[model samples]
Target: MVQAEPETAACMALRDELLGPLRKQTLSTEKLCEVGRLFCGAPERMSLYGVAAPHMEAGGVRVRGRTAVECTIDEYAGEAADAVALYAGNLREGSESDPLVVDLFCGSGNLGHHLGRRLGRRVHASELDPQVYETARDNLSRVGSGVEVEHTDYRHLIARLGARTENDVYVVEPPWGDAVGAVGLDLTRTTPPVADILADILRARAGKSCVVVTKTTTETVCDSLRNAFRGAAHLCSFAPSAPGAGVEFHIFRLGATDQP
Candidate 1:
């Protein structure tokens, strides 16, 4: 009974029907090699379902100070940022102080900054990696992005801020190795597991409503996610059709909260 159930169901159905074939499709090693050469990461990340060098795929190289450092699929990241902003802004449970948009495993704050700006709301980003956290804090500060970059664990962040708030949105894109597989993404494999993360979130909310938009590959297995996060909504940017060019988004909504 969430805001966009019917639309989300259509997206999920398409992905489910096409997932098997997509998994069988050969994953080109060229992109993997290129990314691997450009950025050192886990071997699993070297796949078509892995991270890109800069995440600013098409436009240009420089990335406006947010360069190869941030690990995101630029195409989907933009779509998701826009989607999250729009989604959060329309939440029926909006509080006096606009609901917070939080990013989990936020790597340099590029996506978070964009989301904050697009949402026109307060945003908080958390990075476990010290180096990345420092970089995000400094860069966001210099640019005056107005996002609060925290060097803390996601669990703690959720427990602290995930109380039954009026409206809040979370963006999650965990690492490829544990989260994504060579053939498809696995929620159970994700570090700390996506289900575990969701459990914490649900527990914190205590039946309150919220949204979690997680970025996954086109090859992501629908069944895994269905079991891990039941009733979640799907947002297909270009994933099922274009595959490598874009990514998939699974939006997990806690309860019924109609949109404006």
Candidate 2:
């Protein structure tokens, strides 16, 4: 992944010159960044992924909520379907007495809700933020497929997961925060490096049949993920997919054949 263009104070000033910083900003960080990309040299029409936005504004950053979710859903609504297909395909290859789905950082139960309803599997999800956790609980509760959600850090959830069967599937889509560096989104910069989260999951599963459905971006850099998986993650998308839509998912099947 490339480092996004620095949206430092000076660069932000450039953006302010055109948009004016004094106003209550209505544009998302991405929209603002895309605009930044326009003035920062890249004039190509953008999906925010083809050409990394590479810029930022101080006042316009969003902490989190529906705005981010709406933008994300628009970009990556296909990933959930892809994940469901992946899990179905995995079941075709092997059998488990009881298979479970997990979401390490379930924001508002979107992934888990879809997986539970579509796959008819027990979905376990956790969210750190109290407000987000409430939203996740409410959504998943309506699924009626017994999706369990916890309001706690993912690390704590990992510790309580106990022993896993051979067919347990894990999904991770940590909070990416509001900043994207010059080149692109760095996996290491996530709340807690995604590699570490995956590694912990692998250890908990104990070298059994494991699969990770992870959220990614077009410009995501993965030196660390490669090292951890010891295998490449296959990029999957929704039907009628757009390459630079700014949303991506990587599926990694690592189990008995993995390296130390």
Candidate 3:
């Protein structure tokens, strides 16, 4: 088990107090700050720790410090994980070769861990942030299978893995934006900017199948994908399950045209 930082320990303590019964209720700014100050010690630090409350409640689990702060708590919901698994199953159906599952931007290994168990495949997951990577590594290790987690840049991983072969499936869910709100059409606004690596991602998996699953407010990124992959691309949108929840997903599948 990885140790939590002092501030993160503070945040987790607050999470425990606020998540259970008060989960549904929205706390006033002053009241929330007051609660946060109990563990975080100061007003400014309390503000930082307070950000973890919603995410902790959503994820329903505790992890290491930086990971709890940097990564989305419950980003890969049950339905979304099922959708990705279903797609993988369909892609692998009647396939002759054993496919490898590579999660390019595995934050806390949520999607990768789910897919590893669901698909029973050799999964390689990576995160760039060292602290988050350690969290992912520890989390995936508990799964007790062929899941390998790495602390490296996605491009570096791709380079080391070399060219993609047939039956190799790459799943990417890059950071769309900072907040949980609407991620606009501009791909450049994303942390790694999908546009910057779309070509590389395609080239790496040139002869194989790859899926880029993301959440966005507009169809601009979809348009960009379609343009890049031509008729080889397929895009689908999943409506939000709840009224206040944002639109769930924008899935882009490529290389299926050549699949047998």
Best by TM-score: 1
Pull out the clashing pairs in model 3: none
The 0-to-1 C-alpha lDDT of every candidate, in the order given, reads 0.55, 0.53, 0.52
Please list all clashing residue pairs in model 2, or write none if there are none. 1-221, 2-183, 2-184, 3-182, 3-183, 4-181, 4-182, 4-183, 4-184, 5-182
**Candidate 2 on 21-47: residue-level lDDT in tens?**
422234455554544354333423212
Report the Cα lDDT for candidate 1.
0.55
lDDT of 1 by residue, 1-260 (tens): 00111224443443333233332222234433333333333223322112343332321212211223235533445666666655554633244646767887776566666677667666777778665577557656756775798999987887788654546777776654545544667777887678777777777677566778776655666677777776555432333222233356666665555545
Q: Which residue runs does candidate 1 get wrong by more than 4 Å?
A: 1-70, 89-97, 164-166, 233-243, 256-260
Per-residue CA lDDT of candidate 3, range 38-92, in tens?
A: 4334333322212333233343323443333233223233445566666544434
Q: What CA RMSD would candidate 1 show?
A: 11.0
User: Lowest-scoring 10 consecutive residues by lDDT in candidate 3?
Assistant: 42-51
Instruction: Name the regions of candidate 3 deviating beyond 4 angstroms.
Output: 1-66, 69-75, 89-95, 143-146, 163-167, 177-185, 206-209, 217-232, 240-243
What TM-score, computed on C-alpha atoms, does each candidate reach?
Answer: 0.65, 0.63, 0.62
Q: How displaced is residue 114 in candidate 1, in Å?
A: 1.4
lDDT-based ranking = 1, 2, 3
